[model samples]
Target: MRRRLRVLVTGAAGLVGAEVTARLAAAGHEVTALVHRTPVLVGNDGTPLEAAGVRCLTADVTRPRLGLSEADHEALAGGIDRIVHCAAITDFGRPEEDYQRVNVDGTAHVLELARAGGADLVHVGTAYVCGERDGLILETELDEGQRLANAYEASKLRAETLVHKARADGVRSAVVRPSIVVGDEHTGVVRDYKNIYVVLKLTTEGKVRSIPGQYEARLDLVPVDYVADVITQVTERFDEAAGRTFHAVGAPLTLRDFSDVMAEYPSFQVPRFVPPTSFDLGRLPREERVYYERVVALYESYFRRRMAFDASNTAQLVARPAPGGGQDFLRRLIDHCLESGYLGAPLPGVADVLARLDLTGADVSGPAANDANGAGR
Candidate 1:
């Protein structure tokens, strides 16, 4: 039997963090959900974490002692046996200073809390920390002197380095580097529709014409549930995962596969992928150019490159296989977006389109089909 632990989870109100908190609570672990602003601990299904016995506390990771009172700090230090550091500004377009402040300096504060509490630490990071380096990325590798795509990538790399350095100071720490996190694998329920959804939304809305990318470039999208599950598992088996890094990723879809799936939907106009060198933004229509510059530009670096993440360490620990990519998963994600009204109300004649495509399986019709309005509850 796994030992019950008091786990302190940062970013407990966010998408991935809330799921982790819910899973930990379901597994009989005492969860202290640290939230900076929103104190609600609800899952995508609207299930309250408080109902699941999660203790919510308002605290800022950027502040000293997590912005907690001395009494709260001492109480946490006494009670928290493990710390899951999931709080970080994930917005790619944010300024460099924001990334340095939150992803880098915020990590330092979490490490201090872990040290003071004498707790094992589980740090959630991104696989893009490998930056512009192509080919296979191993869990053991941190710095390869590769060029980073954005401030987000650089900051996470530095944060992971801090965690690695903390191990030398006797802080037992493990890092979970998850690739682009998407919706739930089974239900396709998602709270936040950032990251890959931006591309889909822009394409489907006809906001952009062409995207500069390699058609064969791999897009490593993992479900949030899988990422959360693996992190919770690592926390449960902390003794084995100490001082190790796990890649919480799966088989990624190539840009061609992504485009092919998007093409299945009638409303979407799959953007043609052009090589970055040959592609000229000036050639685009004025509206498309402006949209690309304002919105799509933030993520252009990712679509242009390909990188494979090896999750062998994580695979050895988790029972389920890594999530797969391709048409089925992509369809489910888009369908959920449509059903949830996140992508705006489904285009007219979507039902006719669904019928013509014959894509509706028993699973697709289970819950999503019942919601005709595609509005969020």
Candidate 2:
């Protein structure tokens, strides 16, 4: 039997936070979900947090003492046993000031809350805090003189630095860095479809046909549930998790594999990969050039980096096996997109097309067959 403790989760309305909050409440813990503008907390699998007995408190992370009233703050400080700091601006290309205020300063405020409550802290960070680099990234490594790719990564690094400083000052803290978070492993259901999904939407819609990237660049995609699981485990087993870092990451897939998988879907348009050095956006069609410049260009770093996260600590602590990142999984993601109408209606399958052709007495042989097969590709 596990002891139920009072736990406070910031950003409870966000993806990972909601899942963590739901899990804690379901496990019989007294969970307080702190939210800002988005007060409704829904787990990754679409479970309402409140219905699971989660108490949602409206507050701003960017504000000191989490913008709570004095009485509320005192009550939280007195009763809370653990604080899971999940509030952070995760979007890329945000203004540096926004990142600093939300991610950096917000973390500082959360630390103060932890200090007041004498609560163990479980901070959610990103594996990309290792920055724009290749090869292996260890959990013990931070600030290896690698250049950061965006303001979001830089802000997370700074926030982690604060956590490390607090740990040195005797705050029981642990950092869990999750790589690119995606849908669930089995159902492929995601709460939100941002990040890589944006570029995926553009490419699959034929809005962007050519992208500048290396064929072998790797993308590490971890399931949202796994990340939440890691966070919840660390919170529950604080004694063993203190003063350590864990990577909640999944297996990685290469750009070639991604392209091949997209090509397998007859409704998906596979983007052509061109080396960054020789690629010129000016040569693209007008509409493609617009989409590339406005949307796809923002995600260029993700398409070029081949960074691998080493999750030795996570492997030791987490009992769940790492989720698969193969063709079938990719297909599952795409299938969900089609089913949810996120990608609009999918085109008819080859067999369906063949049946229609038979009814119309049209040829399904030679060049016509090849043309039908190559419709989306």
Model 2: per-residue Cα lDDT over 42-77, one tens digit each: 778676656555888898989988898888887888
Q: Estimated TM-score per prediction?
A: 0.89, 0.89
Instruction: Report, for all candidates in order, the number of backbone clashes.
Output: 0, 0
Candidate 2 off by > 4 Å: 344-377
Angstrom error at residue 229, model 1: 0.5
lDDT of 1 by residue, 192-223 (tens): 88977877887776556577888888888888
